[model samples]
Target chain A: MSIGLKKARAVIRATLSKGREMGLSPLSVVVLDPGGHVVAFEREDGAAPGRFAIAHGKAFGAVMLGMPGSAQMARAEGQAYFMGAMNGLFGGQVVPVPGGVLMRDGRGRLAGAVGVTGDTSENDAEAAVAGVEAAKLVAEA
Target chain B: MSIGLKKARAVIRATLSKGREMGLSPLSVVVLDPGGHVVAFEREDGAAPGRFAIAHGKAFGAVMLGMPGSAQMARAEGQAYFMGAMNGLFGGQVVPVPGGVLMRDGRGRLAGAVGVTGDTSENDAEAAVAGVEAAKLVAEA
Candidate 1:
């Protein structure tokens, strides 16, 4: 029921495909297991190294908190100090942004998460959802 | 020239392909740029999460030291304290093991490095060389 390697790679491929279809800039995509460990990751040709960290942070934060990126962003706005502390606790892997999407399996159990970077927050979120859905998993963005 | 996404992904694909052909264990591969930044990474299905960190550390250590993993291992044997200090300096990203291979361009300039994990050290090094060579880059192992 976790995010297996096949699904993780599929999510990365689909995310990049959707980004190309939408004409978004090169992107970095990261898939993390429920434990906030990287399952798979890729950075597009033009994507910078920092993009990977951001994408990973977003996904790690969402997965660790059991909340979607949007909710994390909202919470961050109201509790900036708490968010900062959490980031420190996790070695700065908490990015409260809209690009992180939690995944659910057939029975609504948590699978993992996908994070996208390289476009605006909203665009990144859109691509993340597209990728998770393409892999036959529900995206809670 | 730096490691581009095309070559990076090719390296990972070829590495996994070679591992499969050799009947090796599932592997995690990491490609790091000359500057010690990640360009691409993938952990095969069933591979433990720690494999990614180990692979990354190997490649990062090789690239940062401007030496192949074999050389690093040899040096570590003779200078364990120095190696330990280097590991601490780099946040434990220095894994002096044979699975890390430095990549070189046609002109003999450093392109990047590849790290492989999930098998015996010799088998991992073999796969790393196979992958870098398959991508038309030279492997310095």
Candidate 2:
């Protein structure tokens, strides 16, 4: 309930628009409550297979770790060793795409997350960010 | 709980011990409840920054979909669709890693998940499997 379903849908709409604006191909986007539960998601046509999942996967990595996927690269030698262990844990459901949104309530506690995949990681991230702005949620600063 | 902390830890310890036994570098491991919450986690001395979270993210994807990351490759065509829809269902906590463990209770109920990243994805998965087997839990058929 951090961001209402109405807003969640709006974010998706905005994300799609952003994807179009960026000239990225089809994309997948997801929004999650702060506790990291799904609230809404959308996958546009023509995205790569696993593209949607990877976006969600990367976003999961970002939101749960409380940062962005780009930043995770610096956490170690990079995401290989780090990513390897994670694959073992979840049985290999981790995709490293960028572009996810974290939602906060009006009071500004972390409320949920949004992740998008398809196109470059950075482009995907831009779409998610645009969605968050449309929803009026701030990233945890 | 599919793999309780006690068992999960045993799996982690054994996995790590095996890694050292095999001359693999230090690894980070995470076990998540069926619902994809952290049950137990271990970060070896050299784990890269945020590697642990990434592993968890991918593993989350595997557990949510009941498939291996490799399986996702087959479904890449539908991947965008999956991600778009699933991220919201999982609240943005799942990732589609290449290899991870799916913790299941007897009688085929999902208990939780295990993700490891450090060595190779296959090696990380092998270690997780060893841990799950050590914990006396059954993998899905």
Candidate 3:
């Protein structure tokens, strides 16, 4: 199932809320559809610069590879050259790191991916997961 | 969060002051809005050739990507091809290196960015920071 704009906005809000709750740094979050296009994004006040692109890179990489960001990170470790090539092919939009999480519907259909930045990678992942779960979707990170 | 012309000029003046105080080489400084459009700039006497373009690229990359130039440089190391493609996409304006700093207002909203050149990258960054501070803005280098 494709992600709608409403859901995308909800994901962003939830992600930001999670970051606030966790006391993480000001965050940037992006929600991308299965096609790797940005559905919605938000860069919080005081967040680091380039966060939107960074967040997009994480989610785009996850969606493009059809894997969770954690898995992508693992693959990047094992296939550094391939990942590098893919990153080039994708115009440097693929960030093989944590904080990119794939979303699935109750019936296990791919919806989209959520990417979070402006904090530690691990913390970003946590925020993404919370956001997806808050929207009643399963997060695969 | 945009910087006015007056503040932009102040940033330029302060940057030059820092350079003069430190006795660095002649310097060029470019201030760009969040959209990567040049707001104000100056080239000190005896500044190296093409310094304006160099400074512009630095500031443009930071403002366009919404990240400090130093962070861009770090990302460029592992994603060489990706960075190359990005550079080409932006008309070779993306300089993935230090000497570019993001400006933030009191509310932490991004105001603009400053790019300094004609000296060591580190020194250029310091001057940019000082310039932003002189304008009463926060610097993220």
Residue ranges of candidate 2 with Cα displaced over 4 Å: A76-79, A105-107, B1-141
lDDT for residue B63 in candidate 3, whole number 0-100? 84
Better-scoring candidate (TM-score), 1 or 3: 1
Model 1 chain A, poorest ten-residue lDDT window?
A43-52
For B73-108, candidate 3 gives per-residue lDDT tens digits of: 887787554455346445578888889999999988
Q: Please report the TM-score between candidate 2 and the true structure.
A: 0.48
Error of 3 at B8 (Å): 2.2
Using Cα atoms, each model's DockQ against the true complex is 0.71, 0.06, 0.25
Model 2 lDDT tens row, A97-118: 4565456667756666778877
Off by over 4 Å in 1: none
- Can you tell me the CAPRI class of model 3? acceptable
Indicate the residue-level lDDT of B112 in model 3: 90
* Local accuracy of candidate 1 as per-residue lDDT tens digits, A24-139: 99999999887778888888887776887899889999988898889988988999898899899889888998999999998999999999999999999999999999999999
lDDT of 1 at B127: 93
Ranking by TM-score: 1, 3, 2
**Candidate 2 chain A vs. true chain A: TM-score?**
0.82
> iRMS for model 3?
4.7
Top candidate on lDDT is: 1
lDDT of all predictions? 0.91, 0.67, 0.86
